[model samples]
Target: MTDSLARMARRWWLALWLAALPALATAWMPVGDPAWPDPQLALVYVERTLKRSDDGLILSAHLALFRSSVYRLTVIDPGADAETPRPTLPESFQQAGSVAGVNGGFFHPDGQPLGLVIAQGRRINRFETTRLLSGVLYSDARGIHLQRRAHFQDQPGIDALVQSGPYLVEHGRAVRGLSTGDPSQRTFVATDWHGHWILGATRTRLTLADLAAALSTPGALTPWPVERAINLDGGSSSGFFFDRGPDVEPVVMRPWKPVRNLIGLTPR
Candidate 1:
């Protein structure tokens, strides 16, 4: 070809590469896991006091069910704890290794329960499932189908019911350390079952009433119709602890740590 033609082709190729550079960068950038360290933690504590004591809200405290002295508080979106590393592991969890559950659920370096498992993505080569969020609750085998719409922006409430935390009941006992995916990643999942819906988040927290109020407005996070919802782990560990006893407000595990992802529940 002519010298000028060759030069023109080279320029075109360079231009094409430059144009694709931004997209490539975005693709390489990690999703779910925040650029900064934001870890979250959740725990199930028993409080005999009618009103639980609080030391300020850690994570985002939203009262779910306050009646019967059994209160459910949804905590979401908090900062990370320095001691923990990527893909945090829990000591209480049963380490089945790769063949067991998804990524290890969010946990303290010493192994603390954060949240339940919901959905996770599989690796391209090893096919390993990576946990996207720390504080979300996931469904059991029968509820596995709830993850069908796992990674979508618009989550169905029913599907979320299968993915949120409330203590995993297996063989009539609560099994601790259940993870669907990983600690290094996070995702937004939601579900709509009847009028009740469930919304999962990482870096987002809204009280049950606040979420209900948000749904009433014109513009909302999830476009689908939602009756009620609660906040889950939002930051790193993205976990919560509900305490209902003598004082007021429920006690949360990591009140300081920032959570990125969480799973919320609504009453029937």
Candidate 2:
């Protein structure tokens, strides 16, 4: 009887310890849905480590969720070589007074934007009907949106917009034809369509198809399920920034090279 009791006790303790391991592992990284943002705050930063279902590879990701009603998304353009000294993402975020930002749009080798870019309610470039330029991230009187190039409408009074992509997610499913090879760093934007949007970047390198599959999976991003997502200018242009506040260190992932435009948030 004594031996049996001891064995039972050992088993119980072992189960308890095993149960605690996952919680202990994700200390800075939350396993479940993180705390929703305070109502008064416009944006909330989230950190998560997601394990891919097939290979069980871990993807460490950073995310920022902002309420659309309280914040207005903008394109912070450095302009057409108008200034001698130009700021990269970190410095641009500092100058614009934005809470969070990510690198935006694709550009040509000569530093010209590849597709439509609107800033401060003016068009910087016109739309291009290329096979790769398949989506648009823009804001208008109806609010922020990620629309397929097929469905997008050219509206007046559009203040902020960037056109770039090969859609990562459409109608909540990963687009089927994304390239599976050439893994690289990535940045993207997703929306729940219930007044919230997210900016995210992968610390781990992944193919576009893998990223699209991971994002379309549930529990990849917290507090809301994604309805739509569009890839931003990734690869070496994959930069991200979020200002936590004065007391906490801000989250910043610098791009490998200089980028032409940035998508950022401003308190309305």
Q: Which candidate has the top score in lDDT?
A: 2
Q: Tens digits of per-residue lDDT for model 2 on 1-268?
A: 6999999999999999999885444323234664555634568887777665445566777888888888878888886564457886778988888889898999987678989999768788789999889999998766888898989898897889999888888777889989999998888998877787888888889888878877776655646667888888888988889998898878999988778899998887
Q: Give a tens-digit lDDT track for model 1, residues 103-199.
A: 2234444343343323222111111123433123333222412222244233333232222322222222223444433322122222333322222
lDDT of 2: 0.81
Candidate 2 deviation (Cα RMSD): 8.0
Poorest lDDT segment (10 consecutive residues) of candidate 2: 22-31
Q: After superposition, how far is residue 9 of candidate 2 from its true place, in Å?
A: 40
lDDT for position 1 in model 1: 100
Count of backbone collisions within predicted model 1: 68
In model 1, which range of ten residues has the least summed lDDT?
93-102
